[model samples]
Target: MNTSTSGTTKNYRVLLVGDEDNSARLILNTLHKVGLECRYAVGAAAGLSAFRENNIHLVLLDLSTPTAETLCARIRENSTKPLLMTTAATDHQVPLIGLKVGADDYLLKPLDPPMLIARVFALLRRVYVYGGDESHVAKAPPSYSDQGSRLPEGWATCEACNYMGPSPRFEGRSRHGQSVMVCPHCRVPAAVTYAVS
Candidate 1:
C-alpha cells in the first residue's frame, strides 16, 4: 500500500455501477474495509447521476449492464478517471468491447479482494499518488535553453513512475502535442524541456 506524506492525504471516491446485489455488496464492503469511500448505483441512470454530482476518483462498472458501453462513453466524455469493468461473460469479445469504450481494465467475476485492491491502488498511484502528468504539468520547471531545438544528454527521472535513469534518445509529444522528453525507464514525460549542460 502507498502511504501519503504530510499534506498529501487524499480522499478517494469510487463510483460503482452494477445491478448484481451480491457482487455489489462484496465490493462495497471490501472497499469500505480498506478505507476507501464508495457510492453504489444499480442502473446506468443512477450511476451517471451520481458520477456527475460527485468528485469520483475511479469508476467500477459491471459489463453485464445492458447499457455498459453507452455509460462508459458518457463517463469518458466528462472524466479522465480510471474506469474498470467486471463481468462473468464467457464471450471473448466482451473485454475488448469494454476497452474500446474507454475502460482502463477489465476483470472477470468472482473478483479476488486483494487483487482488486491492488489494481485500484495501482490506478490511483499512476494518476494521483505519484507525480503524474496531471499533477506536474503546471509546475514543470522552465525550459533549459531557447537557442537550440536539440535536447541535452543527461540522467533524468520519470516523475510518473519514479524511475531514475538516462533519458531516452528521442523527445516525445504530450497529449496536447507539445514536444517533451520522457524517462527511459517508464516512458512518462521526464521534463517539458531540456538544455545542453
Candidate 2:
C-alpha cells in the first residue's frame, strides 16, 4: 500500500455504486469496521444523487454497473477525486478504460477483500494529502513550472522523472489540454514528437 500523510486524518465521504447487495454490504461493513465514513447508492442515478449532497472524496464503482461509462464521464467533468472501479476476472480492459475515464485505481473481482481496502485507503490519502507523489513534483526547479502551458489543476508533476502522472484539474479552460499528460522527465521522446499524454 502507498502510505502518505496528507489525507490520513480527514474523513472522506466515499460513494459506493453497484447493484450487488451482498458486495456492497461487505464493502460497507469493511470500511465502517475500519473507521472510514461512506455513503452507498444502488445504481447510477442514486450514486449521482448521493454525490450531489456529499463531499465525496473518491468513488467505488462496480464494473457491471449500468451506465458506468457515462457515470464516469460525468464524475470526471465534475471532480478530480480518485475513482476505483471493480472489475471481474474476465474483464481485462475495465482497468484501462477506467483510467482513461479518470479512474485512479481498480480492484479485480473475485475480490481479495484486503486489497480493495488497501486501495481505498491509499487513494483517499493521496487526494487529501499533498506529499505522496508531490514529493518528487515539489523538487522541480521553478523553471520547470509551466507558465504558458496550463496543467490540469492538480495533475502531479514529478521532478525526478518529470512525469506528470495524473491529478484532478481546474474547471473551464486553462493553459493545459487536460490529457493524461507526461512531463519532460517521464521519458525522453523522439525529437519529432511531443509528450502530450
Candidate 3:
C-alpha cells in the first residue's frame, strides 16, 4: 500500500519484492524511523507494478523472487535508481547473477537492520546526489564531489563512460550549477576540448 508522507517528509521509498513477511515488517519499521517509506509486494509482478505506480527511491529484492532477473530488467528500463538484493545465508553464488541482472549490491538473508540502513543510505547518497557520470571518490560517493554535479536540475552525464549523476529537482534558474560533465575517474573534461570541424 502507498501513503503520502504525512508526519514527516518521506526521504526515500523502497520496494521489497518477496514473500518474507517478517523481514518486510522489520524493514518497514527501520525505514520509517529514518524518514524512508518502504512498501512491500508479495511477488515479482506486484512488485513491478508497485514500483511503476509510485515515486520509489530504492529497491530491495529477495533472490527467491519469481522472475527475479526479469523484474530487475523492467525496473532498469526506466530509472537508474539503486537495487539491492538479499539471498539466503549460504547463497554467496547469487550476487554474481544478481549483479549481471542489474542489481547494485547483495546481502545475506535475515537482514541486519543497522547494516541494511547503512547500505540504503549509501545507495541513496550515490544515486540521488552523485551525478551519474561520476566515478571517482571526489565526484561520487566515497567523497563529497558536488563540483561537477548539476545538483539537487538539468541532467549531467560523464562523457567518459556509462556513469550518470542525477541532480535533485528544484525550482528557479535553470542554471543549477556549472557541472562541466567531466569524467570522475580520469578527472578530465567531459566533452572534447579540442577544435572541431
TM-score for each of the candidates: 0.63, 0.60, 0.62
> Which one wins on lDDT?
1
Alpha carbon lDDT of residue 57, candidate 3? 73
CA deviation > 4 Å runs, candidate 1: 1-10, 131-197
The CA lDDT of each predicted structure is 0.66, 0.60, 0.62
- Predicted structure 3: lDDT: 0.62
> Which sequence of candidate numbers ranks them by lDDT, best first?
1, 3, 2
Could you give candidate 2's per-residue lDDT for residues 6-69 as a string of tens digits?
A: 2223355667888856877787776654445668887788877777677676789886888877
Q: Give the local distance difference test score of model 2.
A: 0.60
Worst 10 residues of 1 by lDDT: 1-10
Q: For residues 29-143, could you state the per-residue lDDT of candidate 1 as single tens digits? A: 7666555667888788888888888677788999988798899999999778889989898897998999998999978888977456656655665676453545522222211
The sequence of per-residue lDDT tens digits that candidate 3 reaches over residues 31-90 is 666556677887888889988887677898887877988898888988788899988848
Candidate 1 versus truth, CA RMSD in Å, comes to: 12.2
- Going through the candidates in order, what is the number of backbone clashes in each? 0, 5, 9
CA shift at 136, candidate 1, in angstroms? 14
